[model samples]
Target chain A: MDRRKYLELFLNESREHLEGAGKQIEILISGGTGKNATLKEFYRNLHSLKGMCAAMEFRGLTELLHAMEELLEWGRAGNSSRLLKTVGTLETGLEEVGALLGLVENGDPDPSSRTGVLKNLRSRKKSRKIDHESRRPRNSGGPSEKPEVSFPSSIRVQMESLDRLLESTAEVVIHRLRLQRSLPPASGGPPGNHQENLRQSIDRLRAEVMEIRLVPFGSIAGRLRDAALDLAKRREKRIEMEILGTEISIDRSTLERLLDPLFHLIRNCVDHGIEPRQERLRAGKKSVGRLLLLVTRIGSELRVELRDDGRGIDPALLKDRAVEGGWLTPQAADRLGKEEILRLVTLPGVSTHREPDEVSGRGVGMDVVATRIRALGGTLDIDSWPGRGTAFRMQFPLTLAILDSLLVQGKSGTYVFPLHQIESIQEVPVGELERGRNRCLRWKGAPNVDLYSLDEILGVGENPHRKGTCPVLFLRTDGSRRGLLVGSILGRRDLVLRPLGSPLETMREFSGAAILDDGGIALLLNARTLLPETPGPH
Target chain B: MTKNVLIVDDTRFIRTMLRDLLQSSGRYRIAAEATNGREAVDQYKSVAPDLVLMDIVMPEMDGIQATVEILREDPSATIVMCSAMGQEALVVEAIHAGAKDFILKPFTEERILTVLRKVLIPQAASPKGSSN
Candidate 1:
């Protein structure tokens, strides 16, 4: 067998196992009590990883894992202090192994590298052993119970195969629709029954294929638990993390892309959101802080809410910071409401920490997290109460590849509006349309809905008004509600969205393009971009 | 008649390499491969190969426990321990659990063949193979 063919498989598997071991190590360091069962499990993972590195001829990595296994054995023997000291060394060694693996994947398998890590491990092991021998007379007792290990039954499948399966399913649905359209009006015939039956079966198959791409949220949440443990230990803070809805599933690619942003959020929670032990006690609260991550399915979106029970963001401080940083004039800052001021924390270079720390304040701002979540077609909202807590709510579409959209025709071209953003479709008489600085439509004693011409907003020229009545889509987001005018309503569709490339990607008004049944492209409108900034009074 | 062999290790790359080496020798037939010791024990009962090549440390159950279980079921099962450097203690433990012979990893093809001959082709094998 060619070794090169297995290089990618080797790299991916190695990285996963290494991450698992690193997480376990983090738990152990954060006062895990070095339970014999946990130590044994950690040792086994390291041992297996060492064998893999050896098979791949990565001598440096194999040596590092070997040392880690030894240190784990000492930890198993009830040497907590010595084990704590070795955790930093092990972490640095793990990082080196990751870098060396990257180099090996690029056709440069340098086995002699990481000599410094090997020497560090060797010296640490010798010194620790000497200390162990000197203190051996006082050691006593061994673990009485061993934990049983169970592995989940799973196999790796290439992502391309999954995408191809979904694409073919979509193609089948498209062809089936075309066939159904071509059929003549059925006069109570068996052919029509067969066509309907075929359509139903095709729909079921498409749904099953879509479910294949769904991965449970636990896959990433497990890693986040480890990260939180590490950060809490480094900051010397006591935090209890409660993760709910790990059973809920999200698109695998979406979960993978969310890892970095979620990591930043968790780190921020530990570093900034949670008050220290002394501060909490002084405030008549429990010494240990609480951080909660809750995932709930809301219609077609997954709403992830992260809440921390600590000193919340002070809106006054945020306003001051905004003014001091010249992000807003003092008068402008004073005019902003508390909720708006709280949102300034997401601005670039806006950090509340008085001094930079090793864990969370490395100069990277929270704006990166907000921008990334937006790029995934999601929205982030912050809610904070002065002395109560802060909660961040992020809602994302279940999958980026397919969406339920309402198709509407404009003056220049047809467009797609995500169905989740539309509250209702109503026809208002053209004579009742009210215009001032912004168009408005008032109906049935309801509040005035800010209206905009979809054609005008899309730079497709002014829309020619219908003679008697006009159709408008009632758009409702969490913060505001508005209306969009279209030439004609063309019903709903399940669209397979393809991202715009190059020059077209610069268009902020459109999110992506979808292919219509007639083989024409329909640009999908971004509802958030079209909504008015402020809600009108009722 | 070719000897049927079961290879057990947690790493896929190592399993593939061993399968290639053993099949190319023409004297051994690859029966199956298992990633962990639990799977190794289950595969042993199903395949019932003439020889088993087992790694010392694995997730779920180590090779020693797997060897003990298999030998309890069939005392005559031929098993060889595959260990890494600096695991002499584990090699001895595995031997006590009824492994027939042992070979250190990163071993050369000649060394592997010699160990196999010592364990399988006992009468034709030279006494020099028993040095370990």
Candidate 2:
């Protein structure tokens, strides 16, 4: 259906309904009927308007109506006494919505999302809660109401059906990809045109399904900001936390997974990255440190950069620490590039902090940041300029449900490798792989690196690959590359990965199963297991 | 024969939207329309449609009340409550009131047809599977 065709109808009916709601509120406020049904009507009027606005994608209007609906609920069951206090705020909210509707009618930019109407509504709710608290003793009525946490509550309407539809859509898309890859192009016929049209239609459907799965970044922005502010206050650090791209949306699961990683990153920024006011003045930087979380959508990926303008990491010190920590040899540390030196801080043993503090150093480690980001099919790059600032640039996939993976033929069978972790795939003669007397292998990229054999590590097959040139896949681990010798490099494809469950999950080698286009399942090799941590050959 | 559907809502826009959606599908026909719960129950008793499209909150009488009233008269009635955002609690109450199923609004054409057909077509085709 053309939703736009009903724009006029929707606006007209919404106006009439909202007008009726305004009067209904008056009757309730003035205690005209003093009946429950009057309040019910008033709530319904706003509720219906909210639904209409939501469907029309009028975000600001929907939020206002939603707030109004919740405020009206305060009067419903146990909280009827608070109605008189809320009526004034409700009137003001309605007036603001009226102005917002006029803007919609005039084709002006939506002011609803940017306005403070919802903020005022929330503040009022808080005050009322306080008022209620003082009047009634503590823990009196057995948990009456949940405090509104300055954010919209998520309601997954028809979550099951939506998920089923997405799965079913993936099946169709995979089928299409397989068909097109196998079949030759049809020349000059309606069949070709039909195929093209179907492709376009399917692509559009996939995009729409993915879009619905996305929630605005603003949904989690509140929590991140709150955490940053709370940490800064405790640390006695004067800092301004600015979050950009609050309106940008991402998959719900991605947002959930990212919350902790972001929290830790923000914690790091506030506690360690931002310098004290005195230190900042001495360094010729602003006293009030700036911690910025900037998010932008680049293609099908999201670039979330957490930057703090403070005392940056000195690469020389980090290099020295790496040597002292035995994570790297002094020579290896000296060979590291500018970017490579900054990365040593993310290593488990190396720490930029001379002393781990109460705020950030306990349960979660900095090493977990890179691992978590990588697990979500993302990459984390640490960049810092000494005495300037440090920025953690993390790029996360829009949807990890479908992963771009490399299909490699192992001795055991075909295995899937996450493309994000894999660096360059090289085909080199076996002669090129030379093990030194000290047991370190020398490759072209590094004078000495750790070499792992797929056949031996995975116990894939009875026979090992010998003789001729071998294809090697180099994976970026921490700041170094680990070379893996595989049987052969098969092709690459976008795969839908399902987590291994039950007895299969017990296996440490494979993280999940990536469903191939041919309806075959290939076990995804877990990089963490494939390359177990060991003291590096300096 | 197409199944008869009774559309109930206080808003004219919503009613018209449901009607258009149902008519366009060609498998269902609007038996009647009612603005509120009082009219909804009365219309159900008279027209006796194969299904009901009920809006949860209305002026005179609510959809939950109408659902209870209709189910009391004919326990075999097929009623699907039409819910909107923030009406989750009421939707649950309607379900307890014996609503067979529910469709959320603002309505998409596909969503409406899928929900109505899900409730109506199954009973029409296989009476034995209608155990619930």
Candidate 3:
């Protein structure tokens, strides 16, 4: 019931929804009328995200996205050039929301950061401008009558309820914790009495509080499907977007935050994945391109898989690009695996288009999508078969509010790693660690990895242990693998994740902070951040 | 024979460029120049110029209003409206306001001459009683 935790979730989710709307609208603009349905979908999605943000009591995000949704709605109803310009406005709004979201996720979100976009949207007043200028009379009547762009009766919600609920829940949690601690220890009572009852009730209450943050997946997926239709039409290609698992429940904030990556993957599939009708016909396939988006749950994680049946990736082409970009030599490129080729497509500024075109395949967008996904502690995988099709799979947690972490003791203090990122922990004998330039450990039958000291990493050292068996946590980041050295492993448990303020947030290694049962702040270290920065090809 | 020309525009850079271009030819001499349409009408009356190059979107009365006023003073006077791509409809309306022709911007020397030659020569060469 921590307010900061809820706020972090809300900010993150709102960002995702805003990004999704931007990507969809941009595609609709580039693809033209064939993307009309997608344009409407984008407008509706913005409205929906706004509604959800309002329900979550994120007033700033709600206000911003609401105004943005109105603008998009006005744009969707207009013709080609108008829609393109409107989408540009949408991008500006999205950028403002993105900057604000970064602030909120780090705590201390600046509400005034987005006044310019809001002011611009309000003053633009598409309907009034169109009506007044178009219908102004030359003779007796003074000015032209403009068509009034009206906001629909819906999209508004009561924020007071969410605020009240947050306050009451926080009070109840504090009270319950106080009462539990006050209970007498080791009293000659049955094991399943008052304490067990209290624990059961607390668990149920915590579950209910978490459930309040869950948003329906359908709202996010609806806009992506619409965008695919619009993009396909514009490209003169047939793309069918089939959404699976639309009713799944994810933290409303997570659903919103996940939109940019999800929408990009869908747009990429339609724009770059599917070939034109003539190409499809020449390839001896149906004219209609098939794009499937399957959002399914795998244990505690949700997998958003977007698969397309068009022209798949050519490893040879990717290899050529890598060699051309000097990322690798011809010999090294030939030795590269299939997955490596797919990874190249996600590299910043690497587009598949030999010549830049307004439409997709000019790959500047996917890098942003990859970064957003990574920021949310998600992993994106690309699988492609030449002449077949390409499928992008992104797996992420359903909740950012709560994280299961492995708390570890270091020289400085106790630090936590999200359990998913910890590949394995091994008690390596001190003798096995060969001292080198920067704590490199060479284990039998394993690659040599750099040893990262938790205290050294956090910049707070109190001598964790000079001589003892050190526990090594192996982590994988973007394909680069590394090991972290912690003084002691403290098992795993679920903790309510809270964002750290800007002062301490400069520490990129730590994602955020969480409060332990003893009321001490634990640093939640992002495993990927722990990896040493690899030097780019010179 | 040298013809008198009136130049109307908001930007000093553009007015200077047009004045230099027209005067450099030695066949045309600048009658007067105005920054806005309101001033343009006053200049047009003072000079009674043979031709006028007018900008459409200027402060203190647009070119269309000045064109109407200039035509009201003398129906024989020729005024060409300067416009950009986004202001095509406004250019059409300016033509209906009794302007003779339009020159698009950012101006090239060739385009300016073509529009100017068409607007000035055709009307000047026509029989005095012929209806346009």
- After TM-score superposition, the amount by which residue A363's alpha carbon in candidate 1 deviates from its true location, in angstroms, is 6.4
| Interface RMSD, model 3, angstroms | 22.7
Ten-residue stretch with the least lDDT total in model 3 chain B: B123-132
Model 1, A220-324: lDDT tens digits are 887898888778888899988989999999988888878888888888888888888999899898988898999998878888989999888888877777777
Q: Rate the local accuracy (lDDT) of all candidates.
A: 0.74, 0.75, 0.68
lDDT tens per residue, model 3, A44-133: 456545544443445666667766766666666787676677677677777767776676666654343423455455444533322222
What does the lDDT come to for candidate 2? 0.75
The chain A TM-scores for the candidates, taken one by one, are 0.63, 0.54, 0.55
Individual DockQ of the candidates?
A: 0.26, 0.32, 0.01
Q: Give the candidates in order of lDDT, highest first.
A: 2, 1, 3
**Candidate 3 wrongly placed segments (more than 4 Å):** A1-200, A319-337, A355-361, A411-413, A420-467, A472-485, A490-493, A499-512, A515-523, A526-538, B1-132
lDDT of 3 by residue, B1-132 (tens): 576789997545446667777777676788899978999999988877888999876656778899999999889888998764345787889888878777765456666776676567655664642222
Q: Give the poorly placed runs of model 1, Cα more than 4 Å off.
A: A1-156, A173-198, A320-332, A354-365, A436-440, A448-450, A455-466, A479-481, A499-510, B1-132
Worst 10 residues of 1 chain A by lDDT: A144-153
Share of real interface contacts recovered by each model? 0.45, 0.50, 0.00
Clashing residue pairs in candidate 1, if any?
none
Q: Cα RMSDs of all predictions?
A: 22.3, 13.5, 32.4
Q: List, residue by residue over A284-346, the lDDT tens digit for candidate 2.
A: 888898989999987667989999998788888889988988988999988788877887877
**Angstrom error at residue A414, model 2:** 15
